[model samples]
Target: MADNDLEIFLTARNVLVELRLNLAKAVSAGYKKGETETAVKSLIEVQQAIDVIDHASEELEELDEAEHDED
Candidate 1:
């Protein structure tokens, strides 16, 4: 493992957890149907989730590369 591997993993884990929670909240808040006013808010959350997922993926990939490089 690299020096920052733990930090990278922890960050990714946190982002993934937040993403799941946000998605759940959006669903629970009536983000599914078009008639609801919360749909827009849900869409914003979903967009933010996309960025969070991307960031987490990058962090994990960096960690993977570091580990493999050490092997």
Candidate 2:
């Protein structure tokens, strides 16, 4: 990957990490406040986001490998 692309990926990954952490905290607080339904919904969304990130990261790795093979 080009340097710029790598930088962008890193920045996105960092933002996702931060978001995940914040969501976790929110979930914890929601549960403590007896907002079970809302907390569960948020948790599900967080899981979905993580899944998308994982899929995208895997696709990128595959593309990188293919590029190396072509080289």
lDDT of each: 0.65, 0.69
Please report the candidate that would top lDDT against the real structure: 2
**Tens digit of per-residue lDDT, candidate 1, span 1-71:** 44366566566667756765766666677644553446456557656766765676677778788878999
Model 2 regions more than 4 Å off: 1-10, 30-34
Name the Cα RMSD for model 2. 3.0
Best by TM-score, which number?
2
TM-score of each: 0.49, 0.60
Residue 28's lDDT within candidate 2 is 66
Off by over 4 Å in 1: 1-36
Per-residue lDDT tens digits for candidate 2, residues 1-71, read: 54456566667767767777776777766456456666667767766776776677777777778888999
